[model samples]
Target: MRTFWGLMRAYWFSDRWREAWTLTIVIAVLTTLLSKAGVWLALMIGELTYSINFYHDAANTSPLRTTLTSGVLVIVLFVLKDAVIAGTRSLVSATLHRKWRGWLNSQFNEALLDGNHTHFHAQHGSADSGAAAPDNIDQRIQESIKGMTGGAIGLAMGLLGVATSLYFVGENLLQTSVEVKGLEFLGSYGSSVLALLAVATYVPINTWIAVRLGKAMERLNVRLQQAEGSYRSELTTFLRRSFHVAASRAEDVQKTMHNRLYGDIDRTWARLIVVTVGYNAFEAVHNFLGYRIIAYAPGLVSFIHNKLDLKGYVTGAEMINQLIGQCSWLIHVMPDIATLRANSQRVTELANAIENVQQPQEFYSQSGRSDFHYASQNPVFGLTIQKLELAHQGEDATPFLSAANLRFRRGEWTFLRGESGCGKTSLIKAINGLWPYGRGTIVFPDGVKSFYAAQEVKLPQVSLKQLVCLPGSEQDYGDAQVASALHKAGLGDFIEHMADESREGKIWDQMLSGGQKQKLVVARIVLQQPGLLFLDEATGALDPDGKIAFHQAIKDNCPDVTVISIMHEAVAPRSASGDEFYHSVVAIADGVATKKPLVPNLPRELTTILTQPRPVEDKWMRFSRRLKQK
Candidate 1:
């Protein structure tokens, strides 16, 4: 309960709280007005019916005209009431929906992307073993925000309407009386007391049922979201890697997707059915008891019979009794309230996850590097790693990199080389502040811009120009400069295609090959002109000559940029003639790193002469020669 209210308070007191509160108040006011108008309309109809049945003959012609006038007035009031209700609801709901979605998206992005906290992507996991980490964060930001905001607004408006109904209906019932066997059973105040008792009894039971169903719903919703996300992720992967899957003839992808949908989704749906069935069964009983209460009560039946005997055919007491029944709106809104609670819990859970990911101390601490801090005010240029030690995530005792110290100076190109799984990528992550399971201090120059090109490139579904100028706008670079960069990266063919104007807004992913995609990523780096560039097998798909060309292009385009590359033996520079390409090489073996100058190559004759063993003289001949000389 505290958590539920906490979520509401956070949203209602947020930066846009004023707008949210204003909309809420307007909706509430509109709902109250509509409810009152509805009750008035109902009363006017009842009065007309009473007059037509009981007083039609005694009334003068003027009374009939008055009734006709009242009917016309009621029609106008009804139309106006509905119009205002619909208008206010539409305006408030649409505004709130948009506001909530924007706020949630900002919060999620800040938590995940800001401050180099991308490690959260690797660390996040669900408590339930059956479920995976919350990968459908985009879905959550869209669906959960919409569901929570709409549910909360609807629940609030429904409660307001119910309150208004009760006030007018209860007041009307209190002004009338019913009698049984010449004895008055329920006067105005007595009927009010009985209604209050009925409400008191109904609220607790309704709340209990709602609470139970809400808890079950929250759990099932989490699982359902996980299952749905997993299924969708699989489908997306299959689509993205369709060519690879076909070439490799891998059947497991299909089988895994099947299991995710049939196995995980089926289990969640089955549980949902059980909870829904139980809730509905109890709801039916609760409704049955509420309607039967007036009939089964000791004095109520006699009261109704006596009212039936009076006024010839229709009775005023019967009308009042029916009006009092409008109080059931309070009971009927329980399901909506429960839905609101469940959705609020889901949104709260996601917010908490973001909060947890932002706080690194909850998982690990960087104790050795406590004294080291990046000073944004007086940032240094280049990269520095001091006393760095990183352990694999969730394994404190087993170190991945131990006590490694390295440095890459400004405007220098350093190659990071190691066998697979030897922590080269981990070192890059540590340097970039993405991996927090390490004790390290990585110092970067003040106001230094850095770009990391990963092994697998991710291109946005935007135009070719926008894709190249990403993290900035196309307006930041001239079309000529963009074309030049693309030409240098071997994507000159795309320039004409991009210049066609018709293809300006088209997605270019499907049109580009694997090598072309890598080249495009290089083009982005050239356009970004970062002071520091980290490449993790960024040109893995490109041929040797293509790799060399792209590396040369970086140096050519951005002369002073520091390049730190993770490369295999095939891609690392092989000849002393190309030694200018790299300043040094840092090799990782086991859990240790060693730095060496980039020798590139030695002459084959020198290598053979140095590596081959010298011939040895016989020990006896050497001893005899030494004695003779002495």
Candidate 2:
């Protein structure tokens, strides 16, 4: 319930809180009125029955006038009651989808994207297993959140209305005395009191048993949701990597993986079925016991026939059944409550994981660095790396780099040159506050907007202009600005397709080639015009000439942009003519970063030479590496 409230309180008190409260009050008042109206309609049936009985008597022949009037009124009340029910259903449903569920969907969706469309904390599980995002956030947003609103809010309000209506309708149950054959003292008590006593005793036991069975179902539902999410996630993965699977001819391997995923769902679903059957069987027997217990009270039939009129007896019977239904509400919805708990728990788990990921903690016992705190007021150096170490993310992994220092002067384009698997991306992420595995400070300049263009470019299904201007409103940037950015990034051919918005899934993804996708992202960075930009091998898909043009375009358009390009040495190479076109290089090797003057950085050779730091004559004696003959 604590976890349940964590999800509710967010949207309940959100910006639409005023609308939320208004709708809540409207539903409550309408529900209460509807319940009262239902009670009135039930009583009107009794009055109608009395009128028919009155007309049946030969002594009172008024041409059935009173009976006809009563019948007409009963029909009107029935129609009105049903109409109100239909209207209320529409009203609540509209509010649920548009106001409550809609708002919640957008809220959690934004959270899932982490406001960057990055889905960093969402797709990647948190460091702590307990605080990780639950599998299949799509399932949470689509189905579970809907269930949460309906079950948590709608069910609660509905139960409240039922309870309120019972207070008035229960008056009919007092018309007769409940007398047990063996216990004649029961006759001294009104039927309502006896009914209440019976309910007070029996309901607790039934509810206790229902709850016990419900608990197992609750745990089962959580497992079921997880398995379903896992299965769905596999399908999504298969689709995303469909091209690779086809090209590599790994269909059999993928089929086996998919089989394993669905097999989990199948096993969990089987368990759920077993539990559901048992629960239903118990419910059937328990509900029968509860309903019959009051109906078969000793001497109740005699009391009804001898002491009450036809109307009184009929109304009493109806009210007694209604009372049972009202009292058994919790028992009836136990399965729903269990499912609701499971959905809300998954939502809360994702919420907790995102919260934890956003918090600044000890990345190492030594601590990790983020760009948030270490902002320098000076403009001379746009960004500074203060003794930052690089480490991969895992328990078995240790920092590969020793504390390394460097500075990026304002408007400088510095190449982050390193060998493959040399933690260049990790260093960039550490400096940009994305990585949480290394220690030291990243001195980000104050009031400087930053953009990171990753190696893999994904174009969302939207207009080319919108894609370029995304993470920012398309309204913010003019079409000309977007078109110019595209032209600058070697995507001049796409300018004609600026207005082409593909609403169909991944159409734009299919339309654009690999090089075009990379350029599209580059255009996005250029269109945004951030003061600081990190390009993590973003030009990998482009040819040598295209790469040269890509770099030149950024320099030309965003002249003062401080660019840190993490260059893969194999891809970028060591010549100015090709991808190695940067003037400065920060080469990371030998677990340290060195500020080298040119491309073809000689740090690896320098470190090798420095390790032989013995006197020339006794070098062989001091270090085994410098053996005389060898």
Give a tens-digit lDDT track for model 2, residues 344-389. Answer: 8877766665555554443122223322335565765678877776
> What lDDT is reached at residue 289 by model 2?
74
Candidate 1 residues lying further than 4 Å off, grouped into runs, are: 1-3, 48-91, 116-135, 177-188, 202-207, 210-214, 277-335, 359-363, 366-381, 496-506, 574-580, 600-630
How close is every model to the real structure, measured as TM-score? 0.81, 0.84
lDDT of 1 at 349: 64
Q: Which ten residues in a row have the lowest lDDT in candidate 1?
A: 363-372
Q: What C-alpha lDDT, on a 0 to 100 scale, does residue 463 get in candidate 1? A: 69
- For candidate 2, the TM-score is 0.84
Candidate lDDT values, in order: 0.65, 0.70
Q: Pick the candidate with the highest TM-score.
A: 2
